[model samples]
Target: MSCSIKPVYGAQHPPLQVMPKGKEERSKTSNKRDAFQDFENNTSDAWDDGDDDLLVMANIQMSLRDVRSTAQAVMENHSKQLSAQNQQTSSVKDELRKLSWSGIPKPVRATAWKILSGYLPASLDRREPTLQRKRHEYFGFIEQYYDTRHQEIHQDTFRQQHLGLGTILKDIPRMTSLAHLFQQKVVQEIFERILYIWAIRHPASGYVQGINDLVTPFFVVFLSEFIDNDVESENFDLCQLPQETLNIIEADSFWCTSRLLDGIQDNYTFAQPGIQMKVNALKELIKRIDVPLYKHLEEHCVEFLQFSFRWMNNILMREIPLRCTIRLWDTYQAEQNGFADFHLYVCAAFLVRFTQDVLREQDFQGILMFLQNLPTHHWQNEEIGELLAEAYKLKFMFADAPNHLSKKK
Candidate 1:
């Protein structure tokens, strides 16, 4: 079988999975080869005439148009959300919350994330000044921690020993830079500065290996908010942006990331109590839900921590595509106490999504490898919606109430 490559799509519309032209050509070639080998004398009907190839391409384009049409609901929701009556209305908030669970429209995702993260000030009067103050403060960090050239040496390995960090991560200093346009060197500098400053201020929970991964979602979301063009269709020329605008994006991302980490800080502190607890919770939940699969894992002596450390650390950002991660985060931010609790359920759903393939692998190495590289590049909005729906259903079935994770508690 040949590789199924996903098409390069625009961000103005929702992701619609399409095959790349190169892959299509390869498939056509493969079909011709099969036709020749299978029945050389009477293979005209069996041979690919390219008619099927045309239909496949046509179907993919139509699917894209459908996704675009579906996103119009978010546009309408944004307009409704602007109504003064909808500002504090429970009905309005409830509707917004419900819509976000499935997906937030790209037209209003930035505003929705701010509202969900509690980063946006509720009082209309305080919004601008609050933003200005935060933006200025962010630059203050740049001036201070980032004064020297970008360096990767440990600040004090003894301090890390004193903190007694239980887990050792390779290349802990550099974090995930989600956007591809930024130069690798530039991205490294940006994260090093921000993370170093954050670590110094927090003291209790300084820069950790996975913390870098946490920053990407916030950065990409906020960058989308600031940049006029879709990042998918065009490259982000960081130098072109006004210094002030760039600073604001950086500040917004930093604060939002800090806010998220605030709730889950226990996970990163010494020994990672949150992760240990989560691993146990996940094992228990899986045992209750899928006994045979749990048994299979147990038989292989495959510890959940071996596979799940990165999952908890990165919030599954590494597992799925960036576009889908945005959609997943929308529901997560919408849920009450989402990051700390609801995320556990999302993980469960994600694991079960590939249960059949996972179960097929009996050995520890096979199962481990299969999970680390889940086939997600070709997944589109439909797949994401279904995943969230399943995740929500799992949350509903297991959680104590409408907005809680029962097993985690």
Candidate 2:
């Protein structure tokens, strides 16, 4: 008697699935293999055909055109999230009340306490220029000398700690360069503990090195605010601030950084596939819309991917001065999700603005580096902002052309 068996995708076979035990089983397997081979051949033919490229390109262009309208939507979203606008003055007072100035180191505590109480002097001498200057000097020194070197060393340490595991992170600091007594082991432990709090809070994006640098200011800012919280309103008695400050920073760290990362995170993971997608999409857009410049760059080999990764990942923060960085961050936070569109326009603007010298360059690497070192002055300039606005306007009007299409037909 003939017999056969056939494989099934899931549970509970139908009555038709029952087959003879021997010859039927062999025929069933052969049929299944033939079916899979047919599927593979058909899929290969569809991809090899170039008919799908134009439709795909059109959809990409169309979405880019919608960027301006989307950006406005993003701005409106953030405007609605500002919950404390009416109580800005009282919020400042409440933040000050929670801090315990004495618990921090002598100098930071002293200066931080003054800022907390609203006793900051209006005028400034060299010896006491202003509270702002001191904070700058402190953070600046740490950034230039210590943070720079610490990355070199701690990167090795981090690899040793997390390597071999799939979850191992290769990029982390060997040592954190904290300022003043905050650099001491115990104090730094507290800082690390707070960072762990932040990491756990942001499970989606765990701790990263630059994150420490970003959060340091928030820690200092909140520490000062919380000083008043430790003291009673009537007698001003000293006590610990609420445990919630840690939680608040944890939660807000996620929210604020998430907003910041929206435009930038693509650079890190997209280094190859993702970055290539964006750069290629931009190229397709330029080819269709701005042919002359596209030909010029293609001749020089200055693909958008080469320069944009750094711009988007760092949000132009590391490349620019701290004052400029903070101001940009303020605007970015204010705009919320629209920052992604704004960031893309800024990238396109930089390319277009530098088109003259860039086109003149002969080598790919030279033009690439030129874009990388593209003037921070340009980024800070008002004209650059106008260019960004113009780019956004264009994108909003025409972005949807390349967004909807089927690659397979």
Candidate 3:
């Protein structure tokens, strides 16, 4: 899909001057002219922003019922798909065989696999050539032999070790300070614990740079929820027992994070294929809905992903404030039918709705910087939720379902 607007580069708007009204009919005529000019300016602004037409555009008719039904069915089918996906596992490979008999679409399953596999990168398995010791240095053998089965346990221990009963206790005061001591010692410590939670749980994917950014909101939210009033208290230990550490070692903390990370692995991939796919998808969606902004971006060589890379990778955590970023994360985590689609819709909504400031950029880099610096504009919660719902609604447009009619016939 492409924009309907003519290509305009660095276009300037003509200034309109309001004229004073004379008496009676003359005054009425002057007022009319002023009103017409104002209306024209408003129309132009709307077009420039790409918001006018789309604001009133009919939403993709997706109901909560539809999302629930689809998600439930997808989850049921996903169990089989996941079993198939994990077929290569030594003991649990049979899970895949069971799913092979299920009626789930292979392509849909494959998409899930693609997204899930990303969270567990090859780097997790291969030891680093350099001798940079990881946090799991304490449990040498378990770290060395880490696999999907013991991930959750590994993560719990990793959290206890790094985040520690002591550090977590100390870190509570820092949450409010948001200061240097807080950022450096406390925030960094907690971040390490969170990263290790991801890393140990995803020993297969291990610690990646961007992941810390991705999980920041989760940590922030979890801390707020779990810590509650005790966040300001001097003694707020998250881990209570050393026995818990042994239990973590046994329970597969690493595997759980791996499963969670699987959906978002593409974000951490160095090759950027996932990012490109998302940008292309957003561009396609925007072109159909808002031609002018699409054309403006294309004309300026401002590919959507250039700026979107960070947002897609970390879901705006790096760019936006914690308050907004966490809310978006909540929706993404809650909706998990591949949060990729929802992210794309939000990107489009921002581009179309915030067109004026975004389009003023002269070059790709400028456009990127503009997007990177994009503030939390005054948008309604309902509208953001609608954009998310629309993203899920649009999934069918991109996803291909398995053919059932041919077999039925």
Candidate 4:
């Protein structure tokens, strides 16, 4: 595997070619030019400011066109690669990983995510059948286990309560309330089913608080497939979509979220040992990479768990915007053990990105407060791409070093 990471920006485009025109075309072009010139002269002085505004608007439109074109080209390239004969081969996965490390284009993000998450087989012939089987299996689980949530016999002996429906219900409303799509009653009902079903199926961890936030990314991405407009900004009626379509989205979200949680299940297990170990690992990692920050944190009696617990438990979902989280997960799904392993490096990079602010804070309270409420509302793909690149660099540098995360003796 190549260690080189590609920059997200700076795609080169071919220049437009000039073709020779016939006499009739030349005459028509000349007449149009003359007419435009006459119009310009007639309105030049009166519409000077309007002309400037029009010029700006034209530039903005051209920029938007270029962006759409680039996104389309990227999506087409991913589709071709994913559809190749050896799509399931390691080489193809590696190429996809490399492409995804930068970012997955939104048009193909759902398919790319399904493939990368190992939910869908690479064989185009088998994909439909697999989806059908998996979707059916998921609904089967729903039928068998979903109704048991209301039964007193299904109550937990320790808590003397039913399944996690209470917690799930509470978290659903709080999760991504800013996005109109998630605010719909139908959307909330789907989320409730997916989370409740997943919790019942996974008995060990059950439903942890932050797990509710994890479902939003998968739900939104899969839901985007059926919607014509952007899921985040545009408000659409879930009633407009067929129940079958909603079922597929729900099942896909459950399976993909399951795939994600599988690698990091220990993070929510008894005592959350996985998260404790990972938070310690993050502390050790930052100590090595930025000794000054580490020592300063230590000197001020700042504990890693104070703020990082949320980071580790929620996978930084609470810290970054949902759009950025989705972009970050594109790379996460592409990487091996990405949620459990690569994410440590990502957290480190995220913390160090705020190094100056952290160091400038004279008190622990100020630093902790600043870290908790980060100014990430305006962040987009570009910022996320940069963060992932830095994380990849960190992984490349320290991943193989056994002592990199070891405690000082």
Candidate 3 Cα RMSD (Å):
32.3
TM-score of each: 0.69, 0.42, 0.46, 0.76
Q: Could you give the candidate ranking by lDDT, starting with the highest?
A: 4, 1, 3, 2
Q: Which wins on TM-score, candidate 1 or candidate 4?
A: 4
Cα lDDT tens digits for candidate 3, 1-409:
8867554422254444345554445646664446444455654753455454543333346799998999999998999987765554423323332342222232333222222323222233332321123324423534453333246665576554343334433433433323432344444544444444454444444455455455343333333333445453224443532543323322222232345467767755556577777776666777776777878888988767677776666665555555454445445543434366557666666566668886777787887777777765554445455655555455445444323111233
In Å, residue 69's CA in model 3 sits off its true spot by 37
Q: Report each candidate's C-alpha RMSD, comma-separated, in the order given.
A: 29.2, 24.3, 32.3, 24.0
Pairs that collide in candidate 1 are: none
Query: Candidate 1's residue-wise lDDT over 98-121, tens digit each?
Result: 778878887788777776777776
For candidate 1, what's the RMSD? 29.2
TM-score (C-alpha, index-matched) for candidate 2: 0.42
| TM-score computed on alpha carbons, candidate 1 | 0.69
lDDT of 2: 0.46
lDDT of 1 at 24: 64
Backbone-clash count (model 3): 19
Query: What's the CA error at residue 15 for candidate 4, in Å?
Result: 86
Instruction: Score candidate 3 by lDDT.
Output: 0.49
